[model samples]
Target chain A: MSEHTVRAYDRDLEALDRKISEMGGIAEKMLSDAMDALSTFDVALAQQVVATDQRLDVLQREIEEAAILTIARRQPLAVDLRECIAAIRISGDLERVGDLAKNIARRATELVDEARTLRAIIGLKSMHDLAALQLKEVLDAYAQRDAERARAVWLNDADLDALEDSVFRDLLTFMMEDPRNISFCTHLLFCSKNLERIGDHTTNIAETVVYLASGAPMPTDRPKTRSFGQAEEKP
Target chain B: MSEHTVRAYDRDLEALDRKISEMGGIAEKMLSDAMDALSTFDVALAQQVVATDQRLDVLQREIEEAAILTIARRQPLAVDLRECIAAIRISGDLERVGDLAKNIARRATELVDEARTLRAIIGLKSMHDLAALQLKEVLDAYAQRDAERARAVWLNDADLDALEDSVFRDLLTFMMEDPRNISFCTHLLFCSKNLERIGDHTTNIAETVVYLASGAPMPTDRPKTRSFGQAEEKP
Candidate 1:
């Protein structure tokens, strides 16, 4: 590749990254608003969250098209090619994160008119906070090309998974205590799961970032039987 | 873009599709076994599910390498390039589906000794059946270059989403009725959500197939809001 073409490809990649980051920013805000909507029962904010998802959808298409164009025109090799591919995949992940946040906001809207408080909201809040933090860290890792930071985010996904388990259990307790809360609590449960999944997708992006930077796959350890054997460990 | 090179590219794409089909077959079997593990509470089956995921991982890398090599060597243009790109993405989705199935099996192992019979299992089974069917349909669509079938699969995803909502509610009811069952119920809930996500990823692959076959971008619809609005209808 000529220097000019390489420069053009770099510029294209940087622009695509910026677009993904912008989508991430919107998704992060959506998550925060969804949580706030849940806490305050703000139906209007929840609606806004749902409406703004179209923007993420548009951005997803735009970034994907840009990546495709870059590949077609530049024929990027090795790391450059991986970076382009990762950018496209990361955009898909970010778009799904936006969708999950929208799901949470929609659930919050559902609870707007309910007369009773759902105990599951507390767990939802914890999940929301953890997912948002992971989103921010993973995006930062991508921007700085810090493979170590990306790996850290990948490892930290287990923390979110554990929290999700705790949240689900607490939600279950609420439902068991009062059958009346089943419908609302169930919505909260789905919302919490969506948030946890958003964290997982962000971790996927972090892993992709690490892979792009290192050209090495992430290590996989078999889940130890002892971990599942101990019932007292609490998630 | 000589005729000879075109034929070579076509041959390579066909070979890549065959490999992906083989991987998909293994993934579908893994999903079925994981569900079997859930139904029977068989820890051994769950362990086997986890062990087999490594094969999917290796297959993912192999397919990726093959796709990359074809792109580098064949230098396919336009629609051909898109097909190659889609092959890489669909393989990634297939691999993740395998991982999700392994996750379900892991959860089954966790709940193996639990005494309570969660009602959500029925709903989960329905979802598993539907997802596996959709995956098979999408793979068929890919093999036949059937854009219409791919679109049908896209439309079918909403049904899975509705089933997911029902399962979420049922699981919440189980959890709320007894805190003692919370741990087992939570694991089941996660497994169901994983199945739902696998369905979603399958839908994504279907969309990509449509795009590849038609050389047109797939449409992005607004997220389904009916489930969210269901909570308000109860009053």
Candidate 2:
């Protein structure tokens, strides 16, 4: 490291790390709150989740700007360069996580007056729980710079895919059982998809963390369980 | 620009740009081919699109790494810094476009044996054409560094959103009209969503182009219609 790069560059990176952590915290809360809103059909909380997404977007922009500025100003090399790029990637993931959570909340608002399909939601609930846990653990892995932890999160994503497949089948079965369930189940299908994508963001973040820690790219293909129609790759 | 930054750095930027154009070409073909696959129920074409996505993914990683390396080696400032950053951002958008196209193709394979709903696909065809046009135009905007052209693409995205709303309503009507239509219509729903997301990626690329050319970020929100549950935010 250059002598000129010590204090100021460290501060810049620390600020970025702090901002990512903040983004992660808000994303996690928004996810859980959105799920809560969905299960209970709370429009207020759902709207809150939507509103929170703006903050996440703002943070994502800020992080990207900061990272670019740091790279330009400090001219970091090797690991430091990786760190900046990883920050951009992770912030992007977190912002998408926020968006996915907001989507779930939006679906909740749409389903407010519909008949409750509690049974259909059970599979989604499991998905939500696992995705939420993955988000939390992945963020922790980032915070700790724990590549192994990130790898674990990466490995567990296949489980989320499995859950999504189950949710897909359940929602389809519900739609088949009663024509009235079509609209509601379609919204639920999107909700399950949103959750699955959130799981994906966590996986993306995990890969970034592993790269940041090891300075090596992870394998190109992740472990995905669902056989066909990979639920909408990133964004 | 720094005295040290002229020759090699320009070559780096050119390489990045060429890779982006290559990626864009693959992505555009994948999108049109996927739509063709969907309309014709061509399983072989769908498989080809799926296989093409791996190439896009590899190109994305390469572009990202090249951008970072250029940033570190050249320590580009001002417009040059923005160029590298824009390349990274635009590559990401293109990669997602490829994935969405792959997703559309995947859905097509799933629907191969099912009874065709040519009527339901009409709106989707319109969407695919528009999204394909948007992708092409936005990429031209990037190549020419024409912010005005980029802005025009950004403004047109709302029309795509309107199209998605129409498609959604049509698919839902189909599902409601015949219980047998549920499975097919649901796949169409996802395909429409995938197209809408491709539009969003174009919007993202447009914004990146505007920033790269003008050194100013676009407004945080683009013009989007269709009130609830905005399609999955960028991955």
Candidate 3:
């Protein structure tokens, strides 16, 4: 490839990366708003989340189409091809992150009239904050070609898993302590799950970033076990 | 493209499709066994489920590599390129479905000695059956290039969502009625979530198939409202 062609292709790839990060920014806001809606019982914010998911859906398709065109027109070989493929995959995962946020918002809408306490909301915010941070860091790593930064995001995923376990146990305790809490507790449980899944998808994006920087695929079988032993110790 | 090369490319694409379907078949079985482990509280079956997941991961990489090679060498355009790209995306979704099944089995291992009655097991079984069926039908549709069949699979996803909702409500009721059931109930809830996610992934594959056959993207923004309604109903 000529130097000019190479430069052009690089620009295109960078543009795709920027679009993905933009989508990530939107997803992060959706997750934060979902949690905020849960905490404040803001049904309007939840509805906003539901409505804005369509934009994410459209952006996912646009990113995908752009990636496909880049591959076909540029015919990037080996590492470049892999990077393009990873970008496409990351876009899909990020879109799902948005969907999970929307689901959390939906649960918040249901809980608006019934939620009496903010304990579950606090746990959810903890998970959401960590997940969104990981997502942003990983996307930045991809843009900067920083594999070490991506690896750090991968390592932090265990912290997210631990928080999810804590939230699960706390919700279970509340449901068992009072049958009247069942309805609200179940909604909180689903919200906690949505948040945890967002973390998982963020970890997936981090893994993809690592793969793009280093041509080796990450090990899929290594189980990162972080036991939340203090489940019963907290109120 | 020369006619001979075009024919060769078509044959290569056909072979890739066969491999993806074979991978899908194994993933479907893995999901089925995971459900069996959940319903029977069978640790041995759960271990088997975990063991089989490795094969799915291997097959996913193999199919992906093959798709990449075909695209690079043949430079297929338009519909042919779309089909190859769709194969890559479908394989990724299938691999994630396998991961979710393994997660369900992992949760099953924790529930083996729990004292909860088997009533909730039926709901879980129903969900597993519906998701597996949807996966099987979607793979079959992709193999046959039947957009009508693929659209049918898309419509049936609501059944899996309903089953997931029933499972969630049943487990919530169990947790509320007995404090000792909290751990098992939480595990069951995760299992149900995993199965529902697998269903969603299968729906994604079906949508891709529709896109490939019709040259138009499937509508992914129509929120399936019944999922929340089912969750709101009484246990």
Candidate 4:
């Protein structure tokens, strides 16, 4: 390939990275908006978050198309191929993050209708904050190709899982204490699971980063502190 | 490109399809074994299912590497590019199917400890069979590039969702009726959710098949009947 061709390849890859970062940004905002809507019961904001998921979905498809086109045009080998694949994989995870956030926002609408707030709501808020923070860090890691930072976020996922388990147990207790709480707590349980799922997606991005940088496969199991004995853990 | 080059490209694409079909077969077996373990409280079968997930993960990575290499080596364009991308996408979905099956199997271990069986188990078994059937049909559609069959599977997903919802409601009732059933019902709930997720992945493949055949983006929403009123329908 000519020097000019190399430059064009670099530019294409840069655009791919930028598009993925753009996706990550949108996903982050969607999550934040969804949480705010959950906290404030802003049905309009929740609706906006739900509507915005279409954008994320569009961006994902666009990235896939562009990546395929670049591969067809450039015939990128080895690292270049890995980078393109990583972008595709990471954007996919980010898109799911958006979808999960939309699901959470949908739950918020129901929660607002069911009750103003519940006892487990406070715990969910904290979990959401922590998860949002982790997502931001992981996205940064992907942008910077910071494997260590990505690994940190990946390791911290176990903490989120533990929190989720605690939340699940509390929701169960809440439902048992009062039959009226069943529907409400059930919604909250699903919301917490969604948040945890977002965390999982972030970790997936982190793992993709490690692969993009190192050209290796991520371990099947994350370094989770929790035992496998907990069957009621994240779904 | 020469005729020889075209032949090589065809051969690579054919291998990709065959690999995906192999993955789909393994995933189906895993789901079946997991369900069997759940039904019979076969701890060994459940553990075997869990162990086999690693093989699925390896196959997924192999598929990704080979597809990327093919993109680099052959530079597939247009429909060929679409075929390669579909293979990657389908394999990813199949890998998740394996993971979800493993999750269901893990729940089996807990379910066995909780109780031999319960009243709601019958509903769960039916749901599993329907979901498994959907998955099998969708896999066949993917292999044959039968968009019509894929569309049929896509529309059938709503029935699975309805069944899942009914199962969820029944489990909640069971949990509410007896405190001792709490742990057991929770596991079953997660198991049902895992099965539902498998159905979701199959629908994803169906959508990919549509795109590969039609050269168009899949519609964001499938032909879902029930109102979007339900919060827990899908991600």
Candidate 5:
């Protein structure tokens, strides 16, 4: 390739990276705001979180299109090829994070009329904080090409899963304490699940980072604290 | 491009398509079996579904790696490029479908000792049937490149949402009817949500089909019957 073509390829990749960072920032904020909305029953904030997801969606589409064009035009090989593919993969995980946040936030409006369960929200908030932190770390890892940081985020997802188990028990107790809490607690349950999924997406990003840095896939099996979607701990 | 090169590109695209179809078959069966496991409390069947998800994951990674390598080697343009991108996107959707199905199946083990709410399962059955049908239709659309059929799947997602609404109300009623039902019904709630998400993924696949056929992106806003993750109908 000519020097000019090489420079153009660098510019294309930089553009894709910039868009992914922008998407990461938006997705992180959405997760934080959605948790706040849930905890405070701030319907307006939740609605804002829902609205912000559109930007992430648009950015993801742009990144994907640009990445494809880069591949077509540049025909990058080896590591360059992997970077473009990583951009596409990471953008996808970030986009789903935005969707999960929107889903969490959308539940806030439903809880406005239901009896408040502040304690239940506390557990979900912890889950949110961990998920948000993991997301941030993974994005940083991606930006820095820090495979170690990404691997740390990858290994630490079990902590989030453990938190979810406790939260699950707490919410179940809240529901049992008052049947009225059933409807309200159920929404929190889903919110926690959403948070857990965010952690999953974060780990997905971390793996992508690892792959981008070193052209090899991570081990498929993550350390399992528990299989998700179970309502209770095993007896 | 040489005729031989063009033929090789076609072969690459065809290989991607075959992998995607195989994934669709596995995911569709997983969804069906998971629901069956949930309704019957079949722990072994659910375990089988969980194990099957590994195959889908492997296929997704293979498809992605192959797609990227194809771009690096063939540098496909226009419609060929879109086909490769569509395969990546559809495999992703299908892989998530497998995960969601595995999630649903995982809950079946939890419900083994709980009091059976066969009535609640009936409502979820309707949802599963609709989601399964949509999955089948969207895969058909993708396989045949039937844009009209894909559009129909995209439009029909609202029906799944409506079914979820009814299912939500029924589960709530059951939880209220018996405190013992709280834990069981919560699992059902997640199951229904899983089914709803399957619908969401089906529509995603539908959109990819439309794009693959026409090289045009669909509108961002789907016709939502109710925003997902909501616990009840609006007042």
Candidate 6:
């Protein structure tokens, strides 16, 4: 390839990476705000989060279209092919992250009647914070093509799983103690699962970053503590 | 283009489509077996469902690799390119379906303790049947390239959601009526959500099929009945 063609391809990749960052930035904010809405019962903010997810969806489709066109045009090979695939994969997962945020937001109104369970809310918030950070770090790693940093995030998923288990147990206790809290606690359980899933999507991106950096798929399953009890590998 | 080259490309796509069918077959069986295990508390069958997921994962990776290579070698344009991308997208969702099956299988043992709520079991079973049928129709739609059939399954998702909501309510009632059923009902709830997710993945394949047939993205949101209440679209 000539220098100019290589430079043009580089520019295309850079533009793609920038689109991912724009998505990551908005999704990160959605996660935080969804948690805040959950905490404060801010239904209006929750509504905003729901609305914002549509933008992410549009962005994902655009990214996928661009990726297909790029592969058709550039005929990327090996590492370059992997990078295009990675962009598509990341866009798909990021789009899901937006949906997860919307799931959390929907629960905000339901939490209004459960003021009694406010004490139990702290656990979910902390888990949300962890997930948000993971999302941010993984996207940054992708932007920098930083495999080691991505590996760190990949390994750190165990912490999010652990936190999820704790939250699950805590919420279960709340519901078991009183029948009235059953609905609210169940909603929290769903929301916690959403957060854990968002964390998993981040790890998916981390795996892609690692693959893009090293030109080999990650050789092992994602690190986890196993209490979720499904024996399938992450994609 | 020479007829010979066009025939070769068609052969490649046919082979890829066959692999997806093989995957669809196994995943559909896994869903049925997982639900059977749940109904009978047959942990061994459940274990088999979990183990079989590994095959689906391997198939997905193989499909993805082949799609990338084909794009690089053939430089397929327009509809041809969309077909390759569609293969990748379908494989991703099919892999998740396997995970959902394994998730259901894991809940089989937990369902053993709630014989009294066996009446509640029927609710979940019907919902499972609905989702399984949707999975079958969607895969067949992909095989036949029937966008209309795919659209029917996509629109039918709302029915599954409403069924899930009913099951959720019933199971919660069981747990609230007797504290001893908390563990069992809770597990059932998770299993129900897994089934609902399996339905969602089918719709995803449906979307891909629509895109594949039209060579244009489906320009509207999937149809749904509103009571599940989350404003954002399916993942």
**lDDT per model vs. reference:** 0.78, 0.88, 0.78, 0.82, 0.86, 0.84
Q: Rank the candidates by DockQ, best first.
A: 2, 6, 4, 5, 3, 1
lDDT per residue for candidate 1 within A27-91, as digits (tens), equals 88988998898888999998999889889989988887787777767777888888877887788
DockQ of each: 0.29, 0.55, 0.33, 0.46, 0.45, 0.51
Error of 5 at B229 (Å): 5.6
Candidate 1, residue A234: CA error in Å? 20
Worst 10 contiguous positions by lDDT, candidate 1 chain A: A226-235
Candidate 5: true interface contacts recovered: 0.43
Q: Which residue pairs clash within candidate 3?
A: none
**Fnat of each candidate:** 0.15, 0.52, 0.13, 0.34, 0.43, 0.42
- Chain B TM-scores per candidate, in order, are 0.92, 0.96, 0.92, 0.95, 0.96, 0.94
Give the Å shift of residue A173 in candidate 3: 1.5
Give lDDT tens digits, candidate 6, residues B152-196.
Answer: 988899898888888888888898898777767778887888888
Write model 4 residue lDDT over B1-235, tens digit each, in one string.
7899999988888888888888999999999999999988899999999899888888898888788778878887778888888889999999999988998888888776574336878888988999899999998887788899999999999888888788878887877676666667767777887788888898999899999988886677876554222465444
Question: Per-residue alpha-carbon lDDT of model 5 for A15-67, expressed as tens digits?
Answer: 99899989999999999898888888899999999888889888998998888
Give candidate 6's error at residue B201 in angstroms: 1.1
Over B19-53, each residue of candidate 5 has an lDDT whose tens digit, in order, gives 99899999999999999999888999999998999
Chain A TM-scores, candidates in order: 0.91, 0.96, 0.91, 0.94, 0.96, 0.93
Q: Highest DockQ: which candidate? A: 2
Point out where model 4 deviates above 4 Å: A115-117, A228-235, B115-117, B226-230, B233-235
Clashing pairs in 4: none
Q: What's model 3's TM-score?
A: 0.91
Tens digits of per-residue lDDT, candidate 2, A154-187, equal 9999898888888888888899899888888888
On the 0 to 100 scale, the lDDT of residue B145 in model 3 is 78
Model 1 DockQ vs. reference: 0.29
